[model samples]
Target chain A: MSHIVVGIAEFKFAEPPHKLVTYGLGSCVAITCYAKEAIIGSMAHVLLPHAYSSSHDNEAPGKFADSAVAAMVQQMEIRDIGPSRLIAKIAGGADMFAGQFMGSDRCIGARNILAARKALDKFGIRLVAQDVGGTAGRTVEFATESGLLVVRTLRGEVKQL
Target chain B: MGSTPFLSREQVAAVEEIATIAAGQAGNALSRLLKIPIHIGVPEVANVKLSEVPALFGGLDAPAIGVLVPFQGDIEGNALLLFPEAGITELEEMLFGSSGQAEDDLRLSAFAEIGNILTGSLLTVLSSLSERVVVNLPPFLVQDMAGAILDAILGEVGTLSDEVTTLTFNLTGLEDASLVKSVLIPGSAGIELFLEAAGRLKTGR
Candidate 1:
């Protein structure tokens, strides 16, 4: 099986017989897109909300939520995968940085989740499922060949998103 | 033992200076990367209490240890920059741009670099201001704050015991906003440099 390691702010796509995995998600969010016709799927791990400028773009153009979504859409476009046909599944974005001593409201987890949703809506891709926003961390895996998503978190909790 | 207090004061001031520079540099770097302005601050001296950090973030079992930076002159006293559990996500976002599913060490690599940059930049500024100092060895990424400190650090350090205060700067959306400005200085280290720098700018009394 072909395995793809998606780095922070990075994204990739492949047809069947390939699997994509990203590990150690604290507050940053991860998104996976899949389509059966072309049998193509892609994933992105974003660290920030938006790309401030063209100068800020990097190898992992999908590192920011806004830009990453566009990056994924662009990848799909290149492969003739229509945006309307793709199903989106997302996971990660836990607040790994919580401390009772720092007070509340510093929790950026909720904000990350909200930002991801808002960004995805612009693309018209249906969000089929999500596992997000908590005090712990998470790891996510997506099998594009099967269109299955597995989310693992600190409580040893594993579920399909 | 007789010179412990004296040594403590000097070390405190040194750390304070480090904090001011670190705060400034970190704010600057993140601003450049995110295009959003960030501000950093440190607590003042009289308020540098070692026990306060654990008390503030401590559970019955989670006793945390902290590093202290004492302020000197316009920046007198110490301020504690405690890293909490929630802080991890913030750091992750700042470093990786998307907190994706990566191994923990890989996730922390970016933040460790940030801490390195903040600390390294602060040391560079301090070297120009007074005595030269370096925080050799990389910053250890820890899920457990107190446990990490006790395990990784050497010697003794203090904390910003009193209220935590932050200094903010408008990097964007401001007409006359200053770039290369000092954001915050705590009670620890040598904060007088901030006042000194401010006075040089005719913004101080």
Candidate 2:
């Protein structure tokens, strides 16, 4: 049976799965990595950029982008997924409530998107596609089997990234 | 009556204060900004009884407030913002200023925007009130049976048991008492700082 993994609040997974999905990504970003030949995939639903800065370390382990990405890559490597073969795609870095948060200043969504990019770059994973940064919150689903990424925004449109 | 778990006196007080401030600000802002007559309800402070909560929705057993569930996260030590489902109707009427059947997108968009405003407003207020408070993520807007909904949310955290204290409020939008937004500070973090602020607010410190 193909494994379907759901990234919980602080749960991070890297495995050869058929699909990885997370729902109700409000101000939380989900990053997905897939390797075609190996059919291995991993996903992280990160809430904060840095674990040390935010008090979320006590509650949400996957909240920090730095740690979450590191953890995701580590998981991928453990499953024999090579970094080079992995194509990266991301979604759900929506600013959630951007207008009231003063756009970029209080914009954690943009920050998450930037941090994800930096982290992926640091790990040598190429970003193939992204649907990030908007006023709307989104739910992202990744199909590791086909390496397809789909993003659905609340009260908005669903797009393939 | 099951006593919710033990939150430090400090944690309990902080919940009341933060909920008061958040609900007040969110309601006022939604009313002023959206002209929807959003009214923040009176704050009700109580411990989060996981057992009672299961009975609240449909008998979904959830661990602590932060535990992750099928689709949501920890829920035990979380606070709640409860609004009558009918309130949605009233809110639609007020937001539209005379509405028939509101479009699905319109309804969902309105909730999303309102959730954004509420979350942002609370962050600013808390930041101003406490030096230690830090908001990591934006508040998520959701609607479900109070129990199941909260269960989904609580599924992400560790067991909350009696550690979580909640402050609930009601809002009146469009003279029909519609819309309820809850700003929950989990029992895990943000509680102690809030209590200290409340003490200062109460003692005029």
Best by lDDT: 2
True contacts kept of each: 0.00, 0.00
Instruction: Give a tens-digit lDDT track for model 1, residues B1-205.
Output: 0112322444445445545665667667865754655554442332222222223333211322233222233232332233434324443453456654567667545445544455445545654454334232334344533322321111112121112222322222234333222122233243444334333333322
Best by TM-score: 2
Candidate 2 error regions (>4 Å): A1-11, A14-18, A53-61, A99-105, B1-10, B13-87, B90-166, B171-197, B200-205
Candidates in order, TM-scores: namely 0.48, 0.58
Query: In terms of DockQ, which candidate is strongest?
Result: 2
Q: Fnat of candidate 2, please?
A: 0.00
- Model 2: DockQ vs. true structure: 0.03
- The two-chain DockQ for each candidate, comma-separated, is 0.01, 0.03
What does candidate 2 score on TM? 0.58
